[model samples]
Target chain A: MKKVKIYVTLRESVLDPQGSAVMGALHTMGYNEVADVRIGKYLELQVDDSERALDVIVKEMCEKLLTNTVIEDYRYDVEEAVSK
Target chain B: MKKVKIYVTLRESVLDPQGSAVMGALHTMGYNEVADVRIGKYLELQVDDSERALDVIVKEMCEKLLTNTVIEDYRYDVEEAVSK
Candidate 1:
């Protein structure tokens, strides 16, 4: 199996109100050194080995289901899965 | 400045319903090669230089705000921030 780690984040141009809220909370809690905060999604997929290229599969998955391409951008890393 | 990337994921013992839902959707969409899915949170913090240790600040933030330590675990990477 292959282990795929995907990160989906808001585009730089978009405003992240959620992030702002967290930053405010951090400041209120005395973490004044925090300048900014941005929140995103992280996904891990266990993909069974297949004839199809893993990159292509991952890209398709990101575009079709994992991400909202209009406002979000996604990137992934594929690695060999070690059995537990 | 320092760029801190934090990944917050559910502990192994917790059930991830959201991930299961995504996996089911992928199967419905014909991406059967995807065997499992796990979803988590990614946070990026732009931290200003300070006398306090970065690792110490990050750990405290994770425990107090960024993560729910009972069911979630968090890890982070700290890097020099590149001005854009």
Candidate 2:
């Protein structure tokens, strides 16, 4: 099987309040070294071996359901799963 | 500066309804090759150089705020950020 890892992040133009809140909390906790924070989504998908190009399928999924596209951007990495 | 990428995932024993729902939708959409799906959080943190060890600081952040040890597990990758 192949495992695909997807990362969906808000576009640079979008404001991320959650990330800002975390940054604030970090500062409050005395982690003064922290400069910025951005929060996003991570997803793992296990797919059976198929003839279709994995990248094509991944893109389809991201555009159709995995990401908003309007406000978010996505990237993916695929690796062969260690079969048990 | 260093860029830390943290991934927080639900423990295998924990139920992931959001992942299940996404899998169901994929199958319904005819992406039958998908066998499993897992959803998690991705975070990017930019930190200034410090005398303290990066791993130690990362662990502290993960334990104190980035993850819920009881139900979630977190791992992080640290890399030098591209200076712009």
Candidate 3:
């Protein structure tokens, strides 16, 4: 099996109100050293070996379901899965 | 400045309904090769230089604000911030 780790983040130009709210909370809690915060989604997928290339399949999944391309950008890493 | 990347994930025993929903959607969209899905939060923090050790600061932040220790586990990586 192959394991894919995908990170979907807001585009640089997009406003991240959620991130801002967290940063504010952090500051209020006395973590004044924190200058900024950006929040994003992290997804891990376990895929059974298939005829199609892993990268191709992952890109299609990201485009179709995992990411909102209009305001978010996604990138992924593929690795061999280790049996537990 | 230092850049801290934090990943907060559900504990192994916890149920992840959102992940299951996404996996179901993928299967409906014909990506049956995907066997499992797990979702988490990825957070990036920019921190100004401080008197405390970076790792110590990060760990405290994770435990106090970035994560819910009861049902979630968190890990972090710290690196020097790259000026843009």
Question: lDDT score, residue B14, model 2?
Answer: 96
The interface root-mean-square deviation of each model, in the order shown, is 0.4, 0.8, 0.6
lDDT for B67 in candidate 3 is: 93
What tens-digit string does per-residue lDDT give for candidate 3 at B1-84? Answer: 998889888998999999999999999998999998999999989999989788888888889888999999988888999998
Instruction: In model 1, state the lDDT of residue B69.
Output: 98
Query: Candidate 1's error at A8, in angstroms?
Result: 0.5
- Tens digit per residue, CA lDDT, model 3, A1-84: 999999899998999999999999989988889999999999989999989988888999999889999999998888999998
Model with the higher lDDT, candidate 1 or 3 = 1
- DockQ in order: 0.93, 0.87, 0.91
Instruction: Sort by TM-score, best first.
Output: 1, 3, 2
Error of 3 at B47 (Å): 0.7
| Each model's fraction of native contacts | 0.88, 0.86, 0.89
* Candidate 2 local lDDT, A1-84, one digit each (tens): 899999999998999999999999999998989999999999999999888878888899999999999999999999999897
Superposed model 2: Cα runs more than 4 Å off: none
Q: After superposition, how far is residue B27 of candidate 1 from its true place, in Å?
A: 0.2
Interface RMSD of 2: 0.8
Using alpha carbons, what is the TM-score of model 1?
0.99
Which candidate would rank higher by lDDT, 1 or 2? Answer: 1
Measured against the true structure, the TM-scores of the candidates, in listed sequence, are 0.99, 0.96, 0.97
